[model samples]
Target chain A: MSHHIVEFKNVSFCYPDGTQALKDISFRITHGESVGIIGANGAGKSTLLMHLNGYLMPTSGTVNIGDVYLTKKTQQEIRRKVGIVFQNSDDQLFMPTVYEDVAFGPLNLGLDEAAVRERVDFALNLVNGLELKNKPPHHLSCGQKSAVAIASVIAMEPDILAMDEPAANLDPRSRRLLINLLKTFEHSKIIASHDLDLIMDVCRRCIVVRDGAVAADGPVMEILTDKTLLEENHLELPLSLQR
Target chain B: MTFDTQYYNIGFLDQLSYKDTFVHRLDPRVKLVVTLLFLFTVISFSKYEIFALVPFFLYPVLLMTLGEIPFMFILKKVLLVSPFAVFIGIFNPLLDSGQVFIFNGFTISAGWLSFISILIKFTLTVSTALLLIATTSFPGVCHALRRLKLPAIFVSQLLFLYRYLFVLMEETMRIVRARNMRSFGERGKDMRIYVRLAGTLFLRAVERAERIYHAMLSRGFQGDMPTLKHFQIKSGDVFFALSALALLFVFRFFPATEILGRFVQGVFL
Candidate 1:
């Protein structure tokens, strides 16, 4: 009863300033598959994540979410199935209060007050953020901000969850909490991060991005432990793996 | 140093707005509409009419007390904005010296009367506006703006500007801190580098705006911004609005201050 799939075919994106960001990249992710997108800095990992929900339309190819192909007209519809939590929680949590931020997506989906409230409560409760609902985004700690940002997207109930560097700003305890929370989500999750250990804990499969292209695609344990492949991509072995 | 203080000052008003008082509980639309009406009525008085504007002070003072906002906080903000009106009105006595009148047996020019009137109006209008935001949350006002049928784009732009102001300030603070740490006494203090920093900040701000737009789009944003706030114009709202308008009408039409003065004269003489 689920068609939760994200497929990119020969997709390429070129910035208007003549910079080619993502070149001929392609991937297919199925329902409930937790995939990690890893790369060195400026290797187009963010650009590739932007393509997942049709935020930046492919300059060359097509992106399909579930049964629908990504198009300008279908973007609003596609956004419902593919929720992308941006890297900076400040950018994502734009509403004044945590409640308003969590309720933003549901309200935009045209749900009535009761339905929006229910979804917001459910989403915030999932992140253990129900107590922080009335506070503004700027008042929250970075980890709390990150949780509320994810809850904002979760309120939409996207079939596929895509997050960019979700653990980039968290302390060890917060990162551990985030990893545990990610493991509990039933949606098909795609996370982009330099935190390889987090990817190792939460993702079953890993795709290595380098030079705006897929450098490797395989199981997480196999790819992450490949020390030579890690060095080639300017990545170090996960600190835990190295020890 | 001044930047840090200004940042906290902005948050102070927001903190005041979130207080759980009756004034804070009032509908923002009611407060917004009433404040605008108060401004118009206060400003509509003739330039030389100073005494009638005194009653308008009751509106803001009442709000301050009911909203649990400190008087000194509002007074400081009102005074901070007083310089512009003071500068403009200072010339009236020199320019319009004709039409002298007697006040407490002393001769004063109509220009002096108008100058004082301007000051009163400035304090009244500015304090009322400050009181409005002090009692009602900014997003509440934006929601009221949307419900009031103002353009959605404009309201959303305003909302985004407010929501992102702190984010932008934090970014700017980090940029400044990075610059300070890397430079000696004057190496990065040159005006040229500051110009370049402004350019870099502009570019970074543009990139951040794009990210925020993408985040909004991903959340099903389609031109119109919706709110989960359900406003009910309860009995308290109508009672507040009607009583306020009635007081404003009486003050605007009648010489309440002059009548009180004469009545006091009758009692004492």
Candidate 2:
């Protein structure tokens, strides 16, 4: 049987304000797949990613990581299974220094100091952010902050990496760096971004969300090249393909 | 100017904390305990005693020089927040009119002596606290607090407060700047405008906090945050603390400055 890293079955979520953020969303990410989630703002891309780690529970359907269903009891394990990098790097990199932020997850898992340090180093090196180890998160440039945020998540060695709008607000050079870095990851990745060029470069498959539901899901080339599907979801073709 | 001053103060201290120096290298717990001890000794002086407090100035002065901190920067920060201490001490001269001593052959009131004492104490305490933050980063202090047996909740609360202070200041500064740009003098300074600004800032802060909490949860954060940098107290730390304690003890009980001054006078005469 092919291993599915993340599986969401008929999942629906409604916020306390009664806003339906996710509606009957169902998807399965196989091991080593790089999938892109694309949607306009408030189309439930982030809300869907939240369910991957049990940060948000599906109001109606089941969410699972591997064979383990997401529940309060399995939350800690599920969190280890799925790592999320939020849109705002500032919100994600909360610890004072870059090293501490990267070690935060593993330490919380009861890892010893040596193990945590090793993981932190490995993660920072993975993102080419080892130089930022001693720098305070707030003092870093936007690009550096995003790099540290990714390192913080990757240090936990999660099975699947889920990032929301990973390319937003990035300069072209940093954005290109991020795309290249994501391409080198061996773990499955689920990225939500409006940067279609980034999606094209990093993701093999794409899923478009609209009105709290999945509008389209297919191979990256097919979904992104379908101008009618892209236009209907309030998204545009990648700049490279626009002409 | 007030907003800018506050913004600059926060950034200035944060930048200064990163400098490499002897004081910054001391274990945070040792620095914390030593600072507290120094504060107690300074504040324990009698209300009318001014001469004895002179020696205690060495603690901050030495820290400033040894730590390579700019003296004028700290002084400016102290003066900026000195109003409350001044307000409290101002009434002392008016309430007590008894004669005390002669200065420059003119009689001085006891009230003046006590008021001066208050001002001295204020400067000593505030400057030391500021220096503590300048030399030791806020997270270092929070870690020290946790290791010192302060409630985990209390330490975490302080950590959260310090972390958000920057975010809050940035948001508030933006709002203030926008108001300044759109309104002329006296137009943007209305109470109603201030009220609305505060309300919006509060709402945005709450939303930002929610986002932060979710981000934290996504990374497997449980109730307590764990730190990787565990501070180990060294021989240098012990030596520093003990020596400061001994020196403070001497400054507290023995009038070394006066004795030294008298010795010099007698020798010269």
Off by over 4 Å in 2: A1-4, B103-106, B184-186
Q: Candidate 2: count the clashes.
A: 0
| Docking verdict class for candidate 1 | high
Candidate 2 structure quality by residue, lDDT tens digits, B24-83: 999999999989988888888889889899888999998899899999999988998999
Question: What TM-score does each of the candidates earn?
Answer: 0.96, 0.96
In the range B76-111, model 1's lDDT, one tens digit per residue, is: 898888999999899998888887657667787878
Q: Which residue pairs in candidate 1 collide?
A: none
Clashes in candidate 1: how many? 0
- TM-score, chain B, each candidate: 0.93, 0.94
| DockQ, candidate 2, vs. native dimer | 0.74
Model 2 interface CAPRI class = medium
